[model samples]
Target: MPMPATALQEQLITAVRQNDAAAITRLLAEGADANAPDGRGFTPLVLAAYDDHLEATRALLAGGADPNRPVGGGNTVLMGVAFKGHTGMAQLLLDHGAELNARNGEGSTALMFAVLFGRHEFLDLLLAAGADATLRDNKGQSARDLARQKGNDHALTVLPE
Candidate 1:
């Protein structure tokens, strides 16, 4: 039988997903796992960061959510923030020591996802975090290549030639 979700864990997840920073703080203070992954492998930090919930993200990080934790399909918090175009959250993760060049299961890094998804601001933030422009995905596609393929001119400009 599948393990039942704990009430505290469920409340924590709801709080983060809803951007309820106050409730999140309370849950964390009560010893909830900030890094707990939901059914989709998405941690509270990842969800908040993806939703641009800066306060919630800050709360989770303060509570010890592993900034480098990988979620759905090897997607890190950085990748989620990048895909969602949350530059501030992306920068926050980087400042908290997130791996800028971390690759997902598909070998796509946050930089690649930012470019492919047209998240120019996030691409810029990732670059500033020292993400390698030359890093390639499983298909051997670099961030620059993905930008070009997707015709995201703004993203193309952020990439190193």
Candidate 2:
């Protein structure tokens, strides 16, 4: 049988949910697995990214969480950062080796998410970081296609046609 979650693991998950950087630090120091996923496969890093908790995301990354790990729905932490328009968090993940072209379950890249969500500020950052503008999602929609569909003409100005 799979072993149950340790007390520290539970607390670490809780700390991440609460955005308690201090508690997360203590838990990591006390030997919690920074990469441990909760019931839904959400690691602390994923949770932090989803919530736009920059400091907590940084701490988890520092603690060795995999930036590429899919946190359910085939979404990476970087995708969450893009969805939330957290350019700094996305930059931090890139610096730590996040795959700029990593696709989620739907084959949608973080660049696609940025365009789909109308996060104009993230477009340049993602492009400069090397996201593939020509990449297609499961629906065969490129980031530019999504932008066109969303009527984000400003994004069209920069994304490939």
Candidate 3:
């Protein structure tokens, strides 16, 4: 019998972790689910974005993977990429329809993570993308408030007053 589909999907997840773009494409063609979760519960898209695997990410996105898949706690690929500080990957995700305003369980958007992590490139990118910086978190803290608490002067400088 052929390999189980779940098993094939597991291999696809592995291919993503290995940064094997060719294998990712091949596996996708062979009926593997691009959204398969790894042993640790992280999906291929999540792994690709987290590791800044641009080619792998592109392949996955082309294969119809969800750019907005929730990693956990309601956080999405864009949020993770925001913290990773990869503008290209973040832009790719955004172009793929990733929501700039997706919130974590704490109600924080990608813009909030960019501010908390001090990812200035992402800060500018998010601001330009019209992210709702005025949105608040579970503590009722807006991105600007979080910036103030973290002493993120740069974020404050660019965030609308």
Candidate 4:
């Protein structure tokens, strides 16, 4: 049988989903698992970053959230933040040791997503964080290729030459 969700785990997930930084802090202080994955394979930090909750992201990161942990579709917290055009959040995760070149199940990295979505600021942030511009996805498309295909000249310029 599948294991049931522990009360603390459920509470932690709830606090993150609701963007309650205080509740998350209290739970962590009381020994909650900061890296625990919910049903969707997303840790609290992943959800907070995806939801653009900078405070919650900061709290979880401070409490030791695994920035490299992959969630639904094999995307990491950095990927979610970058894809959503949250440059500040992306930079924060990068500074906290997020792998800039991390690839998803389909081999798409955060840089590729940023360019494909026309998030120039995020693309710049990812590049500055040392994401490999030459890295290709499952379809063999690099971030530059995606940017060119989408007519995102600003994103194209952010890529390494």
Please report the candidate that would top lDDT against the real structure.
3
* Residue 37 alpha-carbon offset, candidate 4, angstroms: 1.7
**Model 3, clash count?**
0
Q: What TM-score would each prediction reach against the true structure? A: 0.90, 0.90, 0.95, 0.89
Q: Give the residue spans of candidate 1 off by over 4 A.
A: 1-5
**For residue 136, what is the lDDT in candidate 1?**
86
lDDT of 4: 0.85
lDDT of each: 0.85, 0.86, 0.90, 0.85
TM-score, cand. 3 vs. native: 0.95
- Model 2 TM-score is 0.90
Candidate 4, residue 22: how far the Cα is off, in Å: 2.6
- In model 2, where do residues sit more than 4 Å from their true spots? 1-5
Candidate 1 lDDT tens digits, 1-161: 43244778899999988889899998888778898888877788878887899989888888888999888789898888777788878778888889989999999998888887888777877777678999889988888888888999997777878
Error of 4 at 114 (Å): 0.4
Which lDDT tens digits does candidate 2 get at residues 16-128?
A: 88888888898888889999888777788988887878778878888888999887888888898888999888888999999999998899999988888989889889998
Better of 2 and 3 by lDDT: 3
